[model samples]
Target chain A: MSDQKEERGLRELYDQDPERADYLAFGRKTETDRRGFLKGAGLTAMMLAVGGAIPFARNMPSGLIPSALADTPEDFTLFGKTGIIIRNDRPVNLETPAPLLDPDVTPIENFFVRNNGGVPEATADPEAWTLTIDGEVDNPLQLTLAQLQSDFETVTLRMQLECGGNGRAGFNPSPRGNQWAIGAVGNGEWTGCRLRDVLQQAGLKSSAVYTGHYGADPHLSGEPGRPSISRGVPIDKALEPHTLLVWGMNGEPLPLIHGGPLRVVAAGWPGSCSQKWLTRIWVRDQEHDGPGMTGLSYRMPRNPVPPGAEVPHEDMVVMGPMPVKSVITFPDTLTDVRADEAFEVRGHAWAGEHEVQAMHVSYDFGATWVEAELEPPTNRYDWQRWRARITLPAAGYYEIWARATDDTGVMQPAVVPGWNPRGYGNNSQHRIALNAA
Target chain B: MRGRKLRTGLACACLGLMMAGGASGQTSDFGGLPAGPGQLETFGNCTACHSTMIITQQNFSRRTWDEVLTWMVEDQGMWEMPSETRQIVLDYLVTHFGPES
Candidate 1:
């Protein structure tokens, strides 16, 4: 693509999704230009540098920079009993263990951390941190945590928040972003005021079609004017009873790593839609094009393409709710099983925007499958617990596969659904290898 | 505390390698990567943005690795490596972490 063409494409992208355009633009800006840009936006570049300016180069020890940085103290625990994988440290992208996510309500600690930019240096103080609701609204409002609590009814609900590229590692050709396994998702109880009620308080104008969320996190390049992530959702989805400006998780104050103080709990949509460390909500006349919104960030090709084929931006569609998927949480891979006895296989199944209708288990590499008993979902948007007992027909190395069907009758594909440039949704069957002795 | 211990352990390992005259060891304690030609180059170039864990976890063909490197440089703002260095790093990655059946 020519430079002019790319620039035009980016401008078009900004028109549609400014957040994603800003994300892309942040990396392209030269250091000199970046400083000028930050100053133009009324932000101090020095403050951003102190906040965490891509420390990988400056802090790296002499010789080869270690995989894990030494001088930089870990802001949070990087590993747990679940054997969580650390992808990056500065911005902190941690993946949960798939086999450890059997619980219906994922513990806040176990929930995956996906940060696009550096954590803000300013520690959140609920008393002082305020959320501004403005743009295309009849009554713009600036409400603090206290006002948020006293002014609206607080409700709690269990919901699943999943990265759009949760299973990017499963792609054959693979993608360039974070190579997440099937662990970049979690179901949690979020307590907050309904986004609809909060929006109604601001009184949305007739032209409001989407929203743009702003958060405290700084860009990875340490640009103060740019947000790490600032995506939004449609007005209807924003107004859903379940959409919330959440302050608590699992009955406790929201953890900073998980976007504490205030965050949007946009259940069912890609987790990017739920902006963390939320500080502002801008109602827009069109789609809120924020970072992670354009150029295959959270968008996927509408139709499957041959592996490694490049598709134009026009053919891509924004990823909304995820697909039906299941994870084998018990009888982990390489587990030893007695051939003479029947053993129970257990796991969790979830379908975004739709309830899981049924689940099936296959012991012979999906040659044959048997229906498994699925416990009803405890709450809307929560994963369903599933279990099945299987008697090994013969002693050998066997693979157990789990497949879930959603209420829409869409079943999990046996392999990656389709090849996209970025590997957006890969809800293939979950397989666990076991030793049947 | 754990980070400090890990750094100390890595230093000890490197010293041991130097004493043994094994300039290039088979594995590194840095990110548990297998040491080979261009390993240091790869680490120095890539770890500036992400942890070695990200690269170590991926298993891809040389072609896919090349594509990933191109995407990083062209889209993700990774500094473009010299052609010869890129080839050496690509070879090391392909030999150590090629596609799995």
Candidate 2:
């Protein structure tokens, strides 16, 4: 049928002049319809017979395009594919508790997958990447992603990256990290260009004072060839103007499974310094031997190792920032009671860079304490979301606890000071047991 | 004649980019296996960066894939094959995924 009347006359000439569409023109064109210009010359001769004169279909190379449809928001449910779906769909328990997601965002699809080696190769050329800041710098730059978007000044915050063994399955006998469950920790916004405006546009010479980074992903597969993960910061958290080097997220771009064009969002530390798919930065001046820094791998033994203890080989250290915690999340654990009904005690409280400031519920296991209803100030280490309301008066088997307190008084430590060999900070408190109507 | 219709539209756009690179190297699933006698002559070099689900999601044991192939050939540069092709890719990954034995 004359190519279906030349595709209904080129969709009625792009529904009648869609801004003179020549497929949104790149230039030179003047066909004037010889039957929809021979249907745009038979769809440009069927796209040059299926592309550049088919040298075997021009090497069919445009594949691997799923990072949730690259660049976000197809009704943003955090890049679906079931890798991160959460809106109260709970199931996170890497080893104890840590599932917060909105007290000020944690959704990179509920962040927290911490792999020492896995999930890399989301490429299709993020503009053929390249960052490379270079060790102990004076000038060694390299950039390119259109020279970091026509040279610097981009900013955009929202922090909280997490991962220092994010609750290593509550460690008691199980150590060795990556049991991760508090959904590791996310919150993005990001939009790049900062790490102190590219380390003060590469000048820093007061003996640098640490910054390190590095990430091109690779490694795993019989492992070892260096580049997988690297960490560092503390040149005053790399000059903190909201320490970045991102490359957009949440608002788009950045999504090589979350770490596209670049990464290193830091915020308040532990998520092993937020270094994903990045690519070198260096700067050090001392102390940062990388390899998860002076080995003992993400340490943490200041003291607390008895439940099956086997750590020896010298007390450990590193794994820092992350303590005041809390969690209960809706009367879950025993539900179905009404002898005296009176529920409502939602959960979520965090600490890391400080400012959770309160959250002290207990009910009957910690024995005494009550004061929940927090959810203010969302950023500066993120995570505060809370909600309370309890009053049973009769029913039996109950427990319910939660405990938080930051802004530097640093509370929430009912027990945890031991489980090293790689099971970093596992703040202890959350307890749920519901049942009353 | 418009330069022979622009040299027949650039020879039909170079035969449509060599027939889309021969229909994407004929649907690459590591494009047809064959080279297996072993000593790991790079059985498609770590599947060009992984997937054998990183050696069948390892449970480990051929002394942990020979201490992870001797730490990726002495600290991450990997590619020093021939110790009889790394004992035939550590004997076909501990004989078809070790550890369960």
Candidate 3:
């Protein structure tokens, strides 16, 4: 459309005030909101008339907001989300800024979102959701949301959900996916019923060796029957108490963007394993071969590969629990602190399926290290917050690096770890830079 | 204090709302991609789904770009182009969009 002018205006407003500009630009949902804004503002008709049509025309829903027309970052904002960097607007992959991830239990607002498909329209009324438990189960139960709540005993646990590609951006030679940094990880106090209880009630058959998960999100290719992504966990993992059919996040109904109503909360694993808008759990006799489960989606190379070597699908191994990782929260990377000032350097550290036993801070690269006070996690999967007092005598520019060692004594690599095709699991030490002028 | 620039990421140049009050027009117009033979085809095909920001953000080897395209077609359901057109796009991508370049 001739909305180069509108984009210019919106970008100007955004530069001045991001939230306000966001509210003005987005802040509207529902077909009513879409029709009301577009018809009244006449931008929709203007866009149609001028551009003929948008690209990926087959994929856009009726009232889809054109993100390409957006001013900066993205032209899209969901209900109650801010400060997230939009990786891809089509499937709604969002990454939170590392500085904003300071809280121990990530609030719904601050939590990152990684969607393989558009949010299902069924999220509008989550109460009507139905979950089917079939395939290798003695008792296949079709449970509704109300039935699930009434039947299962609910429990809450603080745990971490990280994307397998959380550190893909750090990979050399550059991978071809969302270039997420450390922001793809978050720890949240999730409240839901144990998956074990449900499977136990359903009575899993001896044939069940794994579980295949299915969600209601639509395919990105606009095919009605094509699944967006179907992934799952091993049988033992699916039976963990921490692996939950989550409905509440930080004491609120899981926000739709974060996979609300009903979804999996398999902590310490790839967030994809915790399928959002969960609808089905297929107990399988073998390893699940779903869309995201195939080839190199979440698999890492078996042997260490050089930076740009091609890896065969058969040689890769499916990633298990994430490795030990940490990030500095306070004194953001862009921060400017006064010289010779003593301040508390604080952050959070976690190991997938492991407890972080020690945390260290390096002021002058890895040449020397000082121990930070690390707190014991409330649960096995919860990230432990660590803090230390440090003074910079004089600063031109300084980087503070954080390293965490798991109970098993595995330390985060100082640089990007070995590379894989899809760039999974690079738990390099997190470093933040600050300047003193 | 550094006077109002929190997000100084050189790669994330096109944030729609949380902007740095800067020129993002470059991101749409090929992100300053040099003029080449297959530039038009690359723009139409690549930007069909994502922004040029996604493209320019990458600093890859020619082989990696090929793998990326192979994934796009095989896994991500990208429409298959003619072999000739594919080679042109590949050559253009490898030439202008390499680590050294």
Candidate 4:
């Protein structure tokens, strides 16, 4: 509460005194904020170094440079995570490169990290971690990892997890936040109990209509009470057998970077629905209105708003299942395929809340199309691998395109589907450049 | 106590920041915005919450820039700037980081 008051005061400084407002915003006390910050030790040193060009002389965070200016550091791929495109470093938001995501089951090292806030400190012992279930329940229960394991029936399923803004980079005029390509996704076999089973143990009251999630991540602003991002599903979606409280990923203890100690994995939904480092589940009688749930945060315009329209809160709806999408993974964008006589191409296709009924590949930019043989998903909600063979007509500067059609008849668009304020639900067909000699 | 304030001003912003020490260039930390009118005010106001990368990377028109500013206050928790300050910052952004620039 005091932090909220302090922040409001800091914001008011801009109107209070425009001249010294910026300096005063950071000062601990309002009384001494203006002149004291102007004559501080760091400013004194900075003034000396810049030879009294005092107005623009305050350096960033004492020798902090923009990550773009710095070369890619060797140490970014920590905890065996590798070959990822790091869009921002402060909160550690990184995405996998398309090539590295080719594996049948995405390896942990190649998985993307989409952190909205600070990565919570790695638990010294994960087993000691506990989870709290409250709100609209007959009995609120606090359970440790051991109890969660022994108390509930566990199930393992291979599921596809994709960010809501997976292909945001393709949006023209650009959308805000992480400019992810088609790599902010992964499929892994997660081991956990159904959220339904656990919530029943808490004895949900009939009024439990929605759920709000909370996690260990603190806000990027370093505010202790603030949550980085919290979102949840409706009562019906929450009750799905696939909605799991996952503790393990791909046969290993969930790595800390991947939200190890505990997380909620609601497959086929936007990755945000699967809260990482989950600590609390607040079952609500109404829809959850937490950070990521309200307004345009992870929502699509209910009625398509023009590119730059100032959409009202009511026009936006919380993101639901991901759209049908496919990506070419194999034959790895080989620069030179010797005058191809039917070279094989393969990739993964997934339909959110549906199945990929068909996948088509084009070597000549949609002028011609050929069907790829789609394999059955190892389990429902898992990605299906598809393969096809194509022969280029007198190869020279060709590209490979892949698109998927969902069971419900939605086809991947060759171009971006619709422009929302945040550049979400971009299920554009993915293509890779290749030179055929 | 005042020293701590300056550090807080420099050390953190609204969006997350990394303390990559030994950075030699002050302007680089300010996202390498070239010196111009409103440069100081813009840096002071914006660097508090976000790295200039957010600004430097955009390719919006002057109109879009204005809309983004309005949206920042309405949706993204940015305080409404004083009228003069807002005009100055807008002018600086368009001049230095507009689509044509």
Top candidate, metric DockQ = 3
Worst 10 residues of 2 chain B by lDDT: B23-32
Q: For candidate 3, write residues A1-437 as lDDT tens digits.
A: 11121112234334433332333444422243222233322334323322333222222222322334342353333444566665545456667778788898988877888887766763556777999999999999999888888899989899989998998888877776777878898889998899999999999999999999998888766668677889999999999878999999999988777877899999888888999888999999999999998888888888988987788899988788888999898978868888888888999999998999999998888888989999999987999999998887786888899999999999999999988888888899999887865
Cα deviation at B66, candidate 4, in Å, is: 4.2
DockQ score for model 2: 0.03
DockQ of each: 0.10, 0.03, 0.13, 0.09
Worst 10 residues of 2 chain A by lDDT: A85-94
Candidate 4 local lDDT, residue A54: 41
Better of 2 and 3 by lDDT: 3
| Candidate 1 per-residue lDDT over residues B22-82, each given as its tens digit | 2232223444457789888887787666556456556677777897888667655578999
CAPRI docking class of candidate 1: incorrect
DockQ of 4: 0.09
**Model 2 Cα shift for residue A317 (angstroms):** 35
- What TM-score against the true fold does each predicted structure earn? 0.75, 0.28, 0.81, 0.78
User: Please, what are the lDDT tens digits per residue for candidate 4 over residues A1-437?
Assistant: 12122111211222233223233222212223222333454455434322233443332332222232122233222334555554544455667777777787999888987878767877888877999999999999899888898899999999999999898877776676777778889998899999999899899999999999999987755557788798999878888999999999999999888898899999899999999999999999998999889977999889987786778879899888999998888776656786757788889999989999999999888888899999989888899999998887785888899999999889999988889988888999999877777
How far does residue A104 in candidate 2 sit from its true spot (Å)?
Answer: 18
Chain A structural similarity (TM-score) per candidate?
A: 0.82, 0.31, 0.85, 0.82
What's the number of clashes in each of the models? 7, 48, 6, 3
Q: lDDT of each prediction vs. the true structure?
A: 0.73, 0.56, 0.74, 0.74
Candidate 1 vs candidate 3: which has greater DockQ?
3
lDDT of 2 by residue, A366-387 (tens): 7787888897654565566788
Clash pairs (backbone) in predicted model 1: A17-A289, A18-A289, A19-A289, A19-A290, A19-A291, A20-A290, A20-A291
Q: Is candidate 2 or candidate 3 better by DockQ?
A: 3
Model 2 ranges off by over 4 Å? A1-78, A81-109, A112-123, A126-128, A132-137, A143-203, A206-235, A239-257, A269-349, A354-359, A362-403, A410-435, B1-101
Residue A308 displacement (Å), model 2 = 55
Best by TM-score: 3
- Docking level of model 2: incorrect
